[model samples]
Target: MPEARAPVHVDGEVVASKRIGGYRHLTLTAPGVPERFRAGNFVAVSVAGHVTRRTLWVHRVRASSAFGPTLDVVVEARGSGTAWLTAQPVGAKVAITGPLGRAFALPKEAVSCLLVGEGYAAAPLFPLAERLRERGCAVSLVVSAPDEARLLSALEARRSARSVTVLTADGSVGQRGTVGDHVDDLVRRSEADVVYAAGPSHVLRAAAGAAERVGAWSQVAVETSMPCGTGLCHGCPLPVVGEDGVDRVVRACTEGPVVRGDRVRWDDL
Candidate 1:
């Protein structure tokens, strides 16, 4: 196990904010985040400077000579909490508590890695791809969305991975199906030794299934409703099957948000 760092509360200024298709991208001038952040870690952001907050996964961590270190999160304004974040003006101050949760573990040695991401879920995988490439791992990506407009970061994926595949539910993009529909073929073609995926429950299950079929290891980042970005709330628990065939419920906030894909009882979820 890794040592846990105490969460720090920082007043982060909105350095930049933009709307990309169905998501809003926010860059915050958070001082401690860049140093403490991990690829799959999320931050508890105070909404509208209120006591209420929302847990947002870290999208990117940038270290700039000019602005120091900044943290980015992609927001889908589905509810009031996220809507408030998207509405904030540039230079507005937002409270943040994070670099929380476990991160996606990279393979120990160089190997072929396949990454699957859906919509805004693709945000975190970019940093993971960059790190994998640094370790001499061959990285490939499959980006999926409902339509062409909603496909997240296609250009960025092309630049980061050795190969990029896009899928759209409407066939408005490269392929006409979910990433789940194409994952098995992608895994076989890439000869991927490991798989990492972030998206909806169905996508995670598919990624796990594909990895299992290929006898490859898999890690998945799951999205759940986390009222308290810590284990205390018991708001985000997922049933997992242990190695001993025991069933246990784990908190997504502390134990995961990232976990071995095979451990999750997807049907139960």
Candidate 2:
């Protein structure tokens, strides 16, 4: 594992921005971000440098001499903060603090890994696929969305994983069904030893359940509203089952955004 650097506040310039289907992909040129960034880590952008900030998961990181390092994030303009973010033009400046929160812990041995994601939630998993492949793991992906137009990073997933399966609710894409509907079959077909997922609570619950059915270890990145990216706000707490079988609330910003799927109290989610 690489050492994690302290978080820093930096002014980043939007080097590139593109509208991909229903999401906006932005590449920001900022010094010292790439080296500190890890797959599954996120950045909190202070929209317009105002008090209002939105937390976004990192999609990719790269090196750049022009700006030192670059960070990428996929934004869905569902709210005012994201609307403002996606509307920024190239060369626009934004304040950001990151590589925040715990990252996915890759399995030590080379094992078949199944990654499941939905819509924009798939943003972080591509980077994770790169790391898993580097570790000699055979990676497969199951990406789900409402329709073909909403499938996030399908090309990227195909490029990164050994195999890719897509699912859509309206049958406008690869298959007609929710990811949960095919998770068990996918897990068995992939011969996956571990499952990693990020999406809505219900989807994650189904993914976890499917993994359990196959006797595979499951790691999940949970989604929640983060008013403060740091743990102080206590706004992103989720119920988790402790070793003693007691349910306790843990802040996603501190303890995890990635947690053991079996340890999470899915019913409480």
C-alpha lDDT score of every prediction, in listed order: 0.87, 0.86
Pairs with backbone N, CA or C atoms under 3 Å apart (clashes), candidate 2: none
Clashing pairs in 1: none
Number of the predicted model whose lDDT against the real structure is largest = 1
Q: Which tens-of-lDDT digit does each residue in 105-204 have in candidate 1?
A: 9888999999999988778899999999999999999999999877888988998999999999999979899977899999999999999999999999
Error of 1 at 11 (Å): 1.1
RMSD of every candidate to native, in Å, equals 1.5, 1.7
| Regions of model 2 farther than 4 Å from truth | 1-5
TM-score of every candidate relative to the true structure: 0.96, 0.95
Model 2 lDDT tens row, 54-147: 9888888877656667888889998888999999999898888877778888888999999999988877898999999999999999999998
Q: Candidate 1: minimum summed lDDT over ten consecutive residues — where?
A: 1-10
